[model samples]
Target: MKKTLLALLCAFITSAASAQSVSTVVHPEWSKNAAIYEANIRQYSPEGSFKKFEEYLPELKKMGVGVIWIMPINPIGKVNRKGTLGSYYAVADYTAVNPEFGTPEDFHHLVNAIHAQGMKVIIDWVANHTAWDHPWAKTHPEYYIHDAKGNFVPPVPDWADVIKLDYGNAQLRSEMINALKYWISNYDLDGFRCDVAAMVPTDFWNDARTQLDQIKPVFMLAEATERDLQEHAFDMTYGWQFKDVWGDIAKGKKNAADLVAYLHGEEAGYNPNSYRMLHTSNHDLNSWEGTEFDRLGDAVETFLVLSNTLKGMPLLYQGQEAGNTKALDFFERDPIIWKDHPYRALYTKLFHLKQTNHALWNGLAGGQPQLIKTADDDHIFAFSRSKDNDQIIGIFNLSDKARKFSSNDPILQGSFTDPLTGQSGQSASAPIELKAWEYRLLVK
Candidate 1:
């Protein structure tokens, strides 16, 4: 009897182990090495229309952008609106496109055009809340949360334009899921970039993901950094902690050691298969906080390189390639002034490297970063990521002063080429010199 009980216990443990080994969230095959670009349609062009933005498809493709995450296309709520145009987060309708951007047909054409260019497109989904004027607010009031006086309230005190949703209502969940399916079934959308995903219930996301996958494999990106979101709901989550660390380093408040510590912490906290979206600037940062130039200053390019070569997926915001310096107005129409900038070339090179090099691919598809110890560990951040035959060693001077560092690691002594400069040379045991905020990438 004791022997039989031991055998049963062993069987149960083996089954549990096998279950834990398998990831619940399966990432789409196309997203394995893809870099995501945030397309802010409202500020992308002077016209701010889908047709106008479609003209840039070839250019974006040339830049090696794989996934284009377009901002919310739903109509804005006019009641209690913040400005003349109102916030994009305040969705007036889920199924209809905002007439200001273009007609629904125009959006359909844009999605088709993006796919034609061999790129995937994902639209922003605001599921946690809806505009105060949303039809459901009146017809199905139970879909929303109410105050003590039976009045609808915003998710937060500051966001008065939008009202919070009640996931406790099962009917609301079904309707919301149905609305999500409508886009996939009608427009053939690849996936969604869920807004404030953490605020909503996790089970809803899991159910939605399962249903969406039944139609087709979808890529889901959450706007939050919560690790649990990646377990079964999202393919990727925002790496806000890394962004904060990068900003602190630029402000002289942190150093290379701090950056290394953060990376180690991230590896320990999050699942290895989960993709984290790394970016120097996004729509929120560019419009609310500041542009990359404002926050990162001279270290802008350095951090950009780090974001791309790090162990996660990199995000390039619209206008970042053009080096737009102004803080775009959030509530009004502020067009990005396109110009010839070095940033475009730099991004092109880094993105191409990310595409061709398996070491820089997204999530588990890429290699884990191994620190290459250097003499100046405080200012010089050096690491190597290798997958099979492909390898990349990144050396960055994270401070303002010049740095001279030498690494005795055997991986550093090899014939490599710089993807950015197209220069080929052999790295010896000799000390390497780098200017303030300079970064070097060696590919083998």
Candidate 2:
């Protein structure tokens, strides 16, 4: 969580530019209620071509996904490459398309296909640094920060393969903002999934959000968790703290009591309008850590439902639906060996259910989750929500055995069928039954 030096410098620059930068004039509301899906292009298919990938838009739409966040499509920098393929974050050109992915026209076709499917696409944007081979490294030497020895360096200790951008120069900030606007203007992109967003100055994000809003409606997502970042900037930020809690519980270091505190603690930090993005796995977990099996294991399904049914937007990574069990190489051409499983069926029901139920909507539009008292508080976590007659109630057995629990909360109002089982859930007179690592979604 170390702050990248560039992030600090951009704060000073944003203050100076605020007087000249355009004020908040253009903004959209639809993004506030959208759910995001990360698309891993390199391993999406055996061929992994843009045209072939476009065909999945209909399938995604059927899953009720609203936003598609594509990983970096720009040309990768070759200098100091990591493996057969370098990190996508190492960008040689901000504007050019990587030939491996396909030509710009092919990407535009994919984008158009996404729009046609009624979903918006946001490309991953690496604003803190560029690949060492970037043209800016040679054209504008002053655009980069110098180390103690007067040499351009990577922003982080281990990121030696790239060069950090200098936000101290007002012109450099302009160049970065222009690059961001270019994507929105040319391809009609909804916004960006900023990489290592916490490493970039909050001010830079505030400014770029302002500029991009001028071009089109944008949804800004940061790969961070702090509330300060959401108070006035990003529409959504990563719920890494929540992720850590689930990881801890799975590892036997924590319990249901910890999860209650985490939910309440994060809610206090975030602003009324901003949201947190919850996910079970992404490119990071796929590459560095093991699969969900390696991380969450048996509780994977339990937590997956929690992520979708809880507050904020829920995300599903590319291979997660298929229950992929491989550790995808971050710096190589590793493709997922997909196999059919119950995960797809489980997630499909939850995804579609999320969109139709008003009590499960995003932001203030959705009802708050009030915890349901249970005799087994250590292992069973239960919560319910009610908006008028519509209600959403969930019960999860987080332990290795069954848990019988009951709640007096009226959010559990009315008798209805459980969405997961198509059977009766807990009624006011009757308690619910939960198997080990099982979760039930009740709607009335």
Candidate 3:
């Protein structure tokens, strides 16, 4: 009986190995209902270590942050580096954890902590380039992109800090795949958010997705807005064009009517399951363009209202919920000063409402957004989201002054309570009044 049991155990192990060795394109169960949270390790906390950030798993879980997308944790290359510590994208070693962040054991602890909170962790991946001091740069020089003079060049003309990778080499592809597998199998990483995905070849990503799915279920988010990148690989793509349009409208360079044409283009250009990440602020905007306060101006609240009600996954960047006013330096050591603020209360209420509103969910599972035709459509934006008996009506004043807007849209003619306050409102034949930057969220 002992001999028979040993044989059965050996067979089970072999079967499991074979299953993991085979690649697939389908994702497993952990990612479907998940919400993504961005973790900027350097600026997230005072210590900026994996150990330090691990303390927030419970709070994140409480706040409904389902998937934790950690910024790059690899050793920052120093040779021709940009800042004191160098860019995280300029990786010195893909296989090892950055000593500045923590040890490999610390990372394991962090991943375990996130998992213990019933959350998933997908890390940021920059596979298109590497730091000049990367070992592969010296040992396998041919793997890098060479210029006319046979010298390795950066990915873009202005990217003087890092070296570009050559994708035409099959050996490089195999090595990258192995590195990815090592992380997934050894650390239990849930998925990846690929940086500048449009710069990389599509076939490589498709292969990577297939290889990753074999080990476990994974979620893939691409930084590119290209439609063909979706295929069987990525679950979501950046809504960059929409974000640019928002910037234009805020600057008075474009009108709110532009959103209609953009949405129509997206509906026809992308896949049905192709999730678009909608955000008010991200790393680039906070670091490069100013904070949401500067970019959105008095229209901030109105834009935030539309961001959640739109047909996409809403993103809350770090410090955004705290009314972050400082412009974070991208290449240096800057910690977000976590403090008591009004934006927290506003976000807490808004997030709570978003969670409970079935009509405001993402994609086909959510209701269609219908704009409420208003008299002052330029300054006052009114819209409604409806799915069956469930509906949410929103009205916001984007201009600098208080405004009264008349909307005759039947969708906005419902009786509902403003969950932000306990007051109930039943619309009549008259127009609704709103103060500058003030917004209303009502549900029926």
Reference-based TM-score of each model: 0.94, 0.91, 0.88
Q: lDDT (0-100) at residue 39 of candidate 3? A: 85
lDDT of 3 at 236: 82
Sorting all predicted structures by lDDT, with the top scorer first, yields: 1, 2, 3
lDDT of candidate 2 over 1-444, digit per residue (tens): 337744644554454434222223232566544677899899888777787789888878877788999999999999988787899999999988989888999999999889988888999999889999999999998999998888899898688779999888899989999999989999999988988888777888888887787677688888887655665567778988878899999888988867876555434445445567898899997788888888998899889999988877899999888898898888877787778878888877887777777777776667777788677778889887665556787888887777776666555656777787778754642677788887777788
Candidate 1 lDDT over residue span 1-59, tens digit each: 96996586566545543443224788999998899999999999879999999999999
Where in model 3 is the C-alpha error above 4 Å? 1-34, 266-268, 422-430
Error of 2 at 109 (Å): 0.4
Root-mean-square deviation of every model: 6.9, 7.5, 13.2
Candidate 1, run of 10 with poorest lDDT: 14-23
**Which tens-of-lDDT digit does each residue in 1-444 have in candidate 3?**
969965865665455434321122344455433456788888887688998889877777777776788989889988888878777788888899999888999999999999889888989888899888899998999889998999999998777778999999999998988888889999999988898999989899989988988898788889998767777678788988877877777777766455544554444456445677888888878888888889888777678766766767777788876778888888888999888776666666666566667676654556766777688866676677876567887776656678887866666655688777768876623587888766777888
**Cα lDDT listed for each candidate:** 0.91, 0.80, 0.77
> Which model is ahead, 1 or 3, in terms of TM-score?
1
lDDT comparing candidate 1 with the true structure: 0.91
Candidate 1: segments with Cα more than 4 A from true spot: 1-22
List the candidate 2 regions with Cα displacement exceeding 4 Å: 1-27, 424-429
Candidate 2 displacement at residue 332 in angstroms: 1.3
